[model samples]
Target: MSTVLAIAKRELKSYFATPIAAVFLVVFVVLCGVFTFQVGRLFDRGVADLAPFFNYLPWLFLILIPAVAMRLWAEERKSGTIELLMTLPVSPGEAVTGKWLAGTLFVALALVLTFPMWITVNILGDPDNGVILANYIAALALASVFLALGGCASAFTRNQVVALVLSVVGCFILLTAGMPLVLDAISGYVPTAIIDAVRSISALSHFTSIARGVLLVPDLVWVVSMVVFWLFATVAVISLKKAD
Candidate 1:
């Protein structure tokens, strides 16, 4: 546990040293403002809730999460630092978990910075704080899922650009897995059970349900399972590459 925290602290500090971190935060804040006010028409809704913000959050994360996770392993391997990293006393699991924690927490920090939206909603009118909290929970889970997938992608390639593209594509599939267009495309060939399964596993579907303040046990399980699966997969990939 100490080893994991040490690695996590190192990774977290590294992010602050890079301009990318600053740029990402700026972009996130700006996009949230634009989407909530202009694109989402938050004022037009005449509601105190941040439903519009949550509605746009997942889509924004499809791009933002991958960009943030692109270097989790790709850059290290590209610079041949993976060899040094692996040689450390840290075990593969510890290293993987530490990096995952660091990346996920970085995204969480950006989410925290959006508290002004919550404050604004409060000042404007009375809203269900419980529902707002639920949506925030959903956002964090969605971010974890995206980052885990992105971390897996980064472990597979040394080029950050390749990592970013692969991560985005993977997250996109998960995000739209349950959408009508995607489901309809495969519905003709697949059985009803498979389609139902697809929707059941979709991050978007679960996120929507939770975002609406319907925090079912299944929704929580879905998010936790996907995040763990991808994180474990990333560890396996890194281990395999080293053996090669």
Candidate 2:
């Protein structure tokens, strides 16, 4: 645990040192403001809820999460730091956990910056705070899943650009796995139960449900499980690469 925390601290500090972190935050804040005021037209709605904001989360995360995670392992490998990192006493699991924690913290920070939107809604109307809280919870879970997937994707390549592209494509498939288009494309031959299972495993499936203010335990469990599974897979891949 200490080893993991140490790695996490280092990774988080690295993010702050790079211009990418500042750019990411600025872009997020600006996009959120534009989406809420211009695209969503919060004033026109005259509502206290953040339904419009939450509705755009999956799409926002689909891009941002991959960008944030693109450098996790790819940059290390590109700079020959992965070998140095492997020489440390830290196990593969510790390294993966630490990086995951760091990325998750970055996502948390972005989410925190969105709190002003919450405040705006509060001042405008009496919204259900519980639902809003759930929306945030759902966002955290979705971020966790994407970051883990991105981390795993990063582990496979040394080029950050390649990592980013692969991560986004992979994450997009995960996000849209349950969408009507995807289902319709495969519904002809696949069994109903299989299609339903695919939908259940999709990131959008769980995120949209929670965003709608419906907090189901099964949905929460699926997201948590997927995050853990992907992180574990990342550790395994790193271990194998080290062995070779």
The best candidate in terms of lDDT: 1
- Residue 226 Cα positional deviation in candidate 1, in Å, after optimal superposition: 0.3
**How close to the true structure is residue 49 of candidate 2, measured as C-alpha lDDT?**
87
What digit string (tens of lDDT, one per residue) describes model 1 on residues 159-230? Answer: 999999999999999999999978999998999999999988888989999988998999989988998999
lDDT of each: 0.92, 0.89
Instruction: For model 1, state the Cα shift of residue 218 in Å.
Output: 0.6
Candidate 2 residue 48 Cα shift, in angstroms, is 1.2
Model 1 clash tally? 0
Q: lDDT by residue for model 2 over 49-163, one digit each (tens)?
A: 8888888878888899999999999888888898899999988889999999999999999999998999988887899999999899899889989999999999988888888
